[model samples]
Target: MGFGDRWRQWMMSCISIPKLSVLINGSPTAQFGMERGLRQGDLLSPFLFNIVTEGLSSLFQKASNLGILRGANCGNGVLISNLQFADDTMLFLEPRVEYLRNARRILRCFELAAGLKLNFLKSRVVKVGMKWSKSNVWADALLCKEGSLPIPYLGLQLGARSNMKTFWNPIRNSIKKRLAPWKSKFLNKGGRLILIKAVLASIPAYYLSVYKIPAGVANDLEKLQSADGKFSVGSFRIQLEDSISDFSVDHKLVWQDCCPPKVEIFNWQVLRGHVMVRQVLHRFGVVQWWEVSSCLTDSIKTWFQGWHGLCPSISHRRVWDTLFAAVIWSIWESRNQLIFNGEDPSLTQAANIVKFRTALWFKHHGRGSKIPISTMLLNLIESCRESPPKKKIQKEEELIPPFSLGLKFNIDSSARCSPGDVGIGGILRNLLGKILGMFSEHIGVYDSNTAEMTAIHRAVTMCAETPGLIGKDIDIVSNSKVTVSWVNANGVGSLKHSKIIYDIRSCLISLGNSRVIFNSRASNSFADCLAKKGSAMEGDFLSREFQ
Candidate 1:
């Protein structure tokens, strides 16, 4: 397959003279060298197999081109001879004795040249838009079995009517087959949901992508997914109703946008008083009353009563719910860790995790309270109390040049999105505001902070490298206050890009009299424009020196 000498050598090393031993009845067979084909499970096996089979596709094409084999005619003057995926080959040809003979000859030629045996017994000659009797005749001629319409191809029925419910039965059966083994195994709601997503959801995706599923079939699949969870909930509700004179709770409160589905399910179980806490286990005679004495002294309502005092503002309901979910989920996880792993539970550690988790969630998903995550972690209640910053009137800000006869680098960075394509640009100007040099370059994929710090680093490096600007006092201006603060503070408390920050600091120190400063975006418009231009460019570093 036109492999280079080095590649060929590497591939041969991987597959040459491999020893194999078979175990029969707990006795190992003698080791034997694999002399015929590539060993099974080798990394290069698939590629080598594809390379061998590729010759067969070419042979079929060659036969069709030479008019030795007649291929099926697609619309718009397109003719298809054969389709090959991995080792499975499907030939499309005009129903003629001559074409079949030519196809057989081509396959034999490929088998001889490639030294790969074709399993004719496992192969099938499927006839389309032709008589059913002719299929057996063709199969006999090819020394293979006959196949009818709607035959399985790549785990999908090729000729089946997709709209019919029968076509979807295979997918449903596959999902059930996968779920059958899982049903016998005891799994939590989280584990079941993961299995449903990872295994069951993927089963129908292949079919759904090729054919639009009928609404009835879709509903049936949904029923299958929720069948176990619904049954459990119904049985528990029935039992609770039998015991209690009045047992009715609105389940809608359990589900919140702030919480994950598993957490919501857990909350639902908790609200229904179905959680197997020590008290519930004691009531069921599973645990003694002595064991339950120190456990769950407060009722469920009292446990969640902290939410009311946490965030009194009605506008911060989402934030409140997020914190509430974080707290409850943390407690649940802590309890599980203590019970399952036998770890000594620390309430303070759990509370800290809950606080940090809530702050993180609010930073990403929650509306209002646009405070820093550190500030939120320090005091969540006060942070939530502070409303989102109101829109202020736009004011013009002027760019201040260097105080002394030194160079000022107005640097700015632009990103398509956070953790996306980033570009850094800087304009070097003297004290009189004359542009000496300017650069616009797409750095790489990074957040805006990294991009901003990179711009400063690049500017400082440029200043240090330039002949005339060497030893000159430099002022690096930027619009990102966070980036500026991090740089000035020597990247203290900056966890994500500490290396980049240190590199920037090193560059600044190398410049001897350089410092990074903060400015409004309005004042750094030229650098911003250049950064945006760099972001749109094809990743080429463009630096222009003005005389």
Candidate 2:
């Protein structure tokens, strides 16, 4: 068939829809007809888009077979025709007239079938390892403009040398634009500080992820920020030693933790008698506050009452603890604003915010807590007493080991020395103690704590990946006191391996049914043996053999 004949045949095959009423403003204004296509803002737009684009994949596959289209062979001998993310598409093709013509034809066919038009004028063709004349000819044949190298895609330069000065200009210019308005004399110091923290400081972070900031650029930015002598409140990398030294005078117990580096710097200030917190308790006079303020004054509230106020019989222990945590969180947040952002610090304001936030956090986390904010603030003690009744929990005997309904994994790790060649091992069992799975890995030259952590991390991962195991109540048993504490607390410390902690916590939180608990080394003998075996091995191994 001829070209006109084929075009007519394709156009005649297109379907048209019946008349539909169109609403302009509030009233029906006209009747119109449109072919059935994917609706704008529909949840299934991406899925439908992929479905429509599947035709391109098939066309390109046939073209590859027919020797009409060629894509760059990226090492493993596999050819890549296109890279797609959401609505953005980058097509890779040999710079040739026939390929360009075929591409245009395929796109036109797709537009006819899916009723989604592609505007060639808006599209740009980028060339790589091709002559300028050849690339210009390809762009002309495709009826698209030639695009420059290093086009911005997904907030990153697609083909730019990341280390070059030109690559950083965009980020530098963006920061300048953001900081310009904040430099006005009309703006207050507090408002400027907020803008600087929120907007100016964050402008370059996206680009910074792609390339390290040069030393000169870093110094220039610091000069622009002019943040000398200001308290850097939000940084996770606080110099704890210097901070503790400053707060340590006359307060002997301020720096007390079994693990010294585990405690955050700001938390030590709000511990008990330090940082004007004594006056805060007196002002609020909430029973929970007063009870824990024994260090502030001897006669105010007893330590025993504070320590054992919420027995196992009380279901509101979580709620009460959340309230205390909310208080500290609010205090810290307020302190940041006051010191760093130039807001005047008020203990009363902090306490008031605590009460408000307590209600919000409790309602969100307490599984439908209906206690009103007014009641919580007015009679905080009574509100705690009036929480829902505690559910009766099955009491496990001290002699009998705790049983989980789904998978139970006893994990252990050992290093030849404290920081030497390490190995991790775990054995999975069901409720009846029949072994279901086992794993062992020699993770080279990590400390004992890291080795222990890796054991639990690998166990949780195995449980997640194994068939019929995900979303099941998986108990991870460990013998190390530090490891159990770290995992049980969801690794909420300032110690090293925060990235791993974040990853493991995210995984566990997603599972929702996973739990970490301590078990005696005697109880975890099999897993311990497997760890010793792993220490002798070269690498990782997993066995699904049930015993």
Best lDDT among the predictions, by candidate number? 1
Candidate 2 residue runs with Cα over 4 Å from true position: 1-46, 65-68, 71-80, 83-90, 115-119, 122-127, 147-155, 185-188, 227-547
* Candidate 2 clashing pairs, residues 3+ apart or interchain: none
TM-score, predicted candidate 1 vs. hidden true structure: 0.33
lDDT on C-alpha atoms for all candidate structures: 0.76, 0.66
Q: The CA-based lDDT of model 2 is what? A: 0.66
- Tens digit per residue, CA lDDT, model 2, 428-541: 877766668888778877888888888888887766666577677888888888877766573475267566666677778767788888877877877888888787777578
Q: Per-residue alpha-carbon lDDT of model 1 for 367-434, expressed as tens digits?
A: 43468888888878667554555776444323466645687788899987666678888888887777
Candidate 1: lDDT of 2?
Answer: 53
TM-score, per-candidate, Cα-based: 0.33, 0.33
